[model samples]
Target: MSGRTRLRGRFQLFATLLVTLVQLPTVLWLCWLTRTPLPLAVAVPVSFPYLRQLQSPWHTTAPALSTYLALGWWAACAVFDVLMLPAALAVQAGLPRGVTWGVAGAIALVLGTDSVLGRPRLRKRVVHVEGLSPELDGYRIGQLSDVHCGPHAPESRVSSWVARLNALDLDLVTVTGDLITHGSSHVEAVARALGGLRAKDGAFACMGNHDYFTDGEHLVRELERQGVTVLRNRGVVVQRGGARLYVAGVDDTWTSRHDVARALAKRPEGVPTVLLAHDPDLFPEAQARSVELTLSGHTHGGQLGVPGVRRLSLARFVSRWTAGLYRQGRSWLYVNRGAGTTGPPARLGAPAELAVITLRRA
Candidate 1:
């Protein structure tokens, strides 16, 4: 290898070692302090395995583990900072100490504030797309994805999301993926909530990875019952004002099979085709199929980002187009940050967003 290449390799190795050192100790310390025997045992065996995966030459798995480690450490630190504040404050008062307690207190305060803050501020991104075929300009498409409607997102939040989308006066509203968390019981309720959305074209959706974890078939049937077209590897041609647009959907990569060729088989020639794939990784396939635009959302813009640095390393491996608009050769990919929160329901720098894309002829 060249000298520069060797230097880069060495720097990567050093970074890996530093990350392992930080993560192993934090995990062990948290396990010890929390008296969580299960986590300790789990952490011990998985530590080397995880580190090995992190150090792997393959970019795919390594970045994913790195992201998991970073997020895990941040979450653990936040928890400890919250739980140990009183004792740390007392210790600080008893002796002259530095501002570690104060720093921890600040993190705890932010965590608490986020917990009670419900949803992050929603922003409408109006993207004007030119070069649309047949003067198919001024077409509005509303996007909502990653609605993990369970404990963190109740029916009320789902209702709010539906209401917001309904008020957008969109030509069509499309939910890319991640409709519900788990269980078939919540599927109907989620569908009912989302059914309130209104658009002249229609509301369509595809299965996400989470949907398969739950009952995918049941969820699809439930959503279809609620007037939303559950497009599983399917395509539909929509015509308006002397112009036609082809809209297609594919299943999640991790779950149910995705057949891009099948989805695009019957699409009309030269019509602007838009695809909805749950994961952004499908962009390459969409581009190969000559798709004009694609919409997706599964990363949630890392859900918790620190400014200036890429938050989710997993997303980087999957797609450079993690959030916002990206060009893949001639095709365009837009990944929404997401409409709702999952798990802890805390968003730091990355706020939830609803994308309103308007297409026009170039």
Candidate 2:
């Protein structure tokens, strides 16, 4: 089965148990505290339906507004479950009512603060490579990933993101995929926004799982039409200051279409190389190929990561390489946190970002 299918099965079971155990108890506790039947009726009605709607048909083709609303509603439900599960258990174990509600409320406040105010920002990182050619040193690459440029992804948001990216002069720009959330309808606006990106060597891209959910080939063509290089199991060489750098891109691994060898086969002998991949699952293979660097951005940093601890997201279970920079011997990988939101249109602890990475010869 596909990754989505496996995750869907697990998510459904987790959701069912969460609602049956956690949310239901939270509602009962609120009703008891208020001593009002009205709260009991309103609490369940307002929240439960959204979770139900979001479930099933893992592949969705609904209106953008409704889908956004449903996702937001689901977000609220998820927050409640995460906060109340322990509280509910404590209450059952005869904890004081005040203590139970206080704990739940505190957790809610922390998560709430993150979701509302965690705006997207630029992150500048200096990565040092041992054998980086001096001519290629100081090379800067701007990364934008998981834009999910669909009906729910606004033109204004993308426009501002593009403006910010262009503001940072970069030697190259790489788009790590999920550019179009749905079909070709949103491709034009997304492409228009990214078309503003400026870099000396130009922007390159690779497909993500969401891109292939519909007609992926069309999306690739549209991106190409916008002057963006959509590299699928291919490699290209770009010259910079008398030095040649090899860049390669692979298709999405989630769909079993990624062929690391096919992509690396085109690299010119003895050239330093960088790779653009949508999912980080192929990092091991890239290391085997001795690729100098790899860029990917599918996890969105789990859409909720602990501020101090980067790897504390549900996405960790999916891929050990969730977000941020990772080094395996000589090969290095940096996963972008994404420039757009997908399901809930909200980011909590894990905020969206435009990454600017500078390379230095170590």
TM-score of each: 0.68, 0.78
Model 2 quality (TM-score): 0.78
Best by lDDT: 2
lDDT of 2: 0.77
Q: Candidate 2, residues 85-199: lDDT per residue as tens digits?
A: 6777888899996888786766655555546334577888887877788899999999999998765566677878877877887899989988877766787788778777788
Which ranges of candidate 1 are over 4 A from the true structure? 1-112, 115-120, 126-130, 133-135, 308-314, 317-319
Give the per-residue lDDT of model 1 (tens digit) for 168-257: 788999999998876665787788888888899899898788888677888888788889998778899998877888999998789548
TM-score of 1: 0.68
Model 1 pairs whose backbones collide: 131-362
Highest-TM-score candidate = 2
Q: 120 in model 2: Cα distance from truth in Å?
A: 2.7
Q: Go through the candidates in order and give each one's C-alpha lDDT.
A: 0.71, 0.77
How many steric overlaps are in each model, in order? 1, 0
Alpha carbon lDDT of residue 140, candidate 1? 84
